[model samples]
Target chain A: MSHGDTIPLHPSSQSDIDEIENLINASVHQSVPSARPPSPPRASIPVSVSAPSPSPFVPSNLPKSSSSAVPPPPPPPTGFGPAPNTLTEPVWDTVKRDLSRIVSNLKLVVFPNPYREDPGKALRDWDLWGPFFFIVFLGLTLSWSASVKKSEVFAVAFALLAAGAVILTLNVLLLGGHIIFFQSLSLLGYCLFPLDVGALICMLKDNVIVKVVVVCVTLAWSSWAAYPFMSSAVNPRRKALALYPVFLMYVSVGFLIIAID
Target chain B: MDPNQPEVENYANPKTCFFHVLFKASALAFYILSALFIDNFVIIFVVTVLLAALDFWVVKNVSGRILVGLRWWNEINDLGESVWKFECLDHESLARMNKKDSWLFWWTLYITAVAWIVLAIFSLIRLQADYLLVVGVCLTLSIANIVGFTKCKKDAKKQIQQFASQTIASRFSSTLQSAFSVV
Candidate 1:
């Protein structure tokens, strides 16, 4: 028989009608069970799993009422969001954010709080590109200030990169290679901020007094930016030890800028 | 919805779009051209200063507010202590912020600073110390904008934290009132 013709809509007799009515009433009773017995064990599993998960931070003593009258608790406040990273973000955004971080680092505004698990944010925040770019830029500028020829300009640029690499290597050896290579490079790179500023000031006037003041001020500023970062990177007991090398590193950078001519 | 979540409002702001490109282009062009070819200290100084001033104005008033939906200012209180005030666009507005505008504004800002530094070096090489003053002015302006904007961002985070606590308090009281009335 065809599908539609296979089933009968009406009950054939009074007994059939009574059986159907009883089946309908039984389902209604099962659904509205507050006035009846508890739900069967098999039926309760899905219901429990479907509930919204409560926060682990919430205290156990708090009311657990899931009734309509009780409102849910608000979400907890979060600290700063993750830094912009290279993978998901557009190239321009990542570059811009990194540049901003350099400025912030120079101003002693914020440090790049990198999580080991998220390489994207870490790499974006501490990318070596920034240091390299600024190094070249500053190298070119400093070379110009010193009246260096085009041939010697290359040497100055290479020297800046070499100095950065030396510090990166020293940091890695000191930390037992526990840190990312780029992180070390970034730290070294940002430390160059003061030297970069001092380089400009030195170019401003040929006076010995101004040069002394600029070098001194920049040394202090770069140290201020690098010390906290170095201290945090190493063990508390060895904080001073790690910071010592960082100081020498910045000092060397300052001396290099001063000796550029 | 969590009350702590930033409330964002998005709408058409042509002023934001206009000033973002205008200020960035003008500032950059002026910086590069003035240092490279102008040579005359007076012309270079006036152009650089005027452009820097325009950039400061545009960033503080227009691009900062419209593009990123953040604005900030420092005011001296009655006791003469400086107080920083920061305002951020609601969540909707921030969500709708054009990525292009923000990228342009920031990149130009940093580039301008770098350019000025390069110019200072060029001036020194040319044995002209006077141009250093112009370079210094431009540097201060760009650095100020960078610091102000970043500080504003930090303040917004604090505001979010405060909003979250307030929401929790209000929610707890509302639930308590309902629970007691039910008895």
Candidate 2:
């Protein structure tokens, strides 16, 4: 009886609500309804005793799982377990490698194409961490610089960068050109680093002429960084149609940076 | 069909589409008839342009988006670059727009422009230089919307077409991949 009382404890904790209701139905399966509460611990008690006599033997699972738990988890951990343990490299090594990859990708994207190779081919591995940082940073700076509507500014700047990257990619694609989606997104986000710099500088400089000149240079820089990738992606005939929006989005960010201050 | 739930019927909502047509018609009517009633050009200009501007704002910002699932704007930067901005709802939402609404929105747009152009010609034949300026301003506003929306519609349709082709291509490629695997 003591063993029967404890039997319901483990399974009641682990089993889902459906199983508990099923156990209740079994306990109350008789025509005469009992006044007992429909809790799991009490409900499962009747299931085990009648389990041996009746074919509706759900308590059979209860004892089997308990015994299974008593046995040490399969000895396969020693044989194949080494693989799982060894699968994970030292944590520091992973962090270092991912960090380096992000940096190099940022470099490849933000800087002018250094090699004569195709930008698409060279960017075999891409991480959105750099883009995410740049966008959030731009949003934060734009929000920080705003005299009013701070949260709204952050939201608009963030959404513009995120959606603009996708729309620009789609624009190029619809114009009948090939480009990888995330890589283009990464490139666009990295391009924001220039505007990110422009925003930061605008935040520091109090003068309007200084802000305007900084925004102009940075806007041109961003457009320049993105120009090769975008222009190359579309057919030469409709290249302006595709590139104009990219220029416009960057110009918008620049304007936001100037306007917010 | 439940009379309480009129939207369940297999038809487009007429109420909103009627208003869409009404706004454009009223704007045109007021601009033309204002010259007859009001002797003052400034009052006519203010009222006529006000109506035209109101229609432009409604069609550009409100009706275009709601009725046809498209919007457009042109922003000229300080550097003198004319940047055309466009917005179009995804294919699903565009499909969900009322057929009558789309029809009414577009027909009214073109017909209104034609009406204004006819007015412009009448002003030209009469050689009423002052009224011609009003027509020109109103004509320019209406045509700007037409061009913007036309380009936006083209972009949206092309996007949906591209999406369809890509989906078919992807499914075809997947089928090929599975066939090779089975082999």
Candidate 3:
């Protein structure tokens, strides 16, 4: 312990210790996945080489570094190499992990009822991204179809959708059924997938009847998908109570989709 | 909700709990005071109603849930029947709520309603029929919130009773079934 403690006394070893501490923080605490091999052993070689120098080196380095209140310059060789490697690799890995998580969530929501498999596990990892994407995408398409003030149309549509989701969640919750706040929000957004798909198709076509039929079908699909979970939230007496607002909002959105042209 | 259970006088958030009363009191004060300063009837009506509406929203959505562990709403069902719904934290959490917060919430709620009613009576006596409309709207909202929350507390009690009975019934049935199977 004494021999190890004596090394930090040397001025050159002081800078080296700071660099090693940074490296340790970056490696262990950061939890980054790097393509490059572990480089800390190579970084520590210089520190070991400087350790055996005289105690006189210690006082000279301490005063200069303490006054500056900044870490000394990292050593020349391996410092520049690993810095770039750390940034790029883990970023791509994180993106892949998050994207896959979003995709799995979408499947759980958009496909059929997966909650039947394990009710506890359903929506265990709810996120706002799916809701945000669905709401914004629906708003943008409706705006494109608007004859005038597309921006106002987008704002109104976005606000309505967002507020509708919150109010609907509160409605179910107040009816005495157990529900997670964000999970319901996420589920509500996913229920809009059918409507979103219908919106995409309707925006391309001009026939009023075609838009009506498509909107009606998609609206029913959205409401049907949302019904089981929302109805189950309240007592049997209040099942219809909790679900009406949900269908009402979906109906309004469908009407907006059909009537936009 | 046992009467014998220890009362929790301490608040989970003692410092900020006053803000609930602060908001309701300010909303009421604004509505009552705005008439004396402002000449425009439309401005008073609109702004006061807006403030009341904001308070209703906050009390319904945020404060009731946080301060007293209750939530309530009314909605129109498919057959055009209006349904009033109420939810509360189960008995344990309700018992754990701060005594001071509940006192403030219930007292402030009833006082606000009473104040609006008095204002309504004063308007009636003074023959200021126009202002009565504003007071009436505000009073209706205030009372609606109280009714909903009152029903919620009762509903929570009913649920506890039902749950206890149901658990006992199920356990008894299971034991009888096992005994019959052995025989």
Best by lDDT: 3
Per candidate, chain B TM-score?
A: 0.75, 0.84, 0.81
User: On residues B1-183, what C-alpha lDDT tens digit does candidate 1 reach at each position?
Assistant: 333422342224466556655765676677677667765444454555666766776676567765655666543233323345565643323434554555455566567667767877886788754555556656777788877877765554444334444333443454455457668
TM for candidate 1 is 0.37
Instruction: List, residue by residue over A1-261, the lDDT tens digit for candidate 3.
Output: 122333332254354444443443344333222422232321111111111111121212321111121222222222222332211123245347547868987887566573474442445556556776788689878888888867567657866897899999998878877776777888889888889999998999988898999999899888877876776667889888888999999999999998886
Off by over 4 Å in 1: A1-261, B1-15, B121-127
**DockQ for candidate 3:** 0.01
Candidate 2 lDDT tens digits, B38-153? 66554455456657765775677667766766766543333323345555654434544555466567767888989999999999999876677668767877898888887876
Docking class of 1: incorrect
The i-RMS of every model, in angstroms, reads 20.7, 28.5, 29.2
Comparing 1 and 2 on TM-score, the stronger one: 2
- Clashing residue pairs in candidate 1 are B7-B90, B7-B91, B8-B90, B8-B91, B8-B92, B8-B93, B9-B93
Clashes of 2: 0
Error of 3 at A218 (Å): 1.2
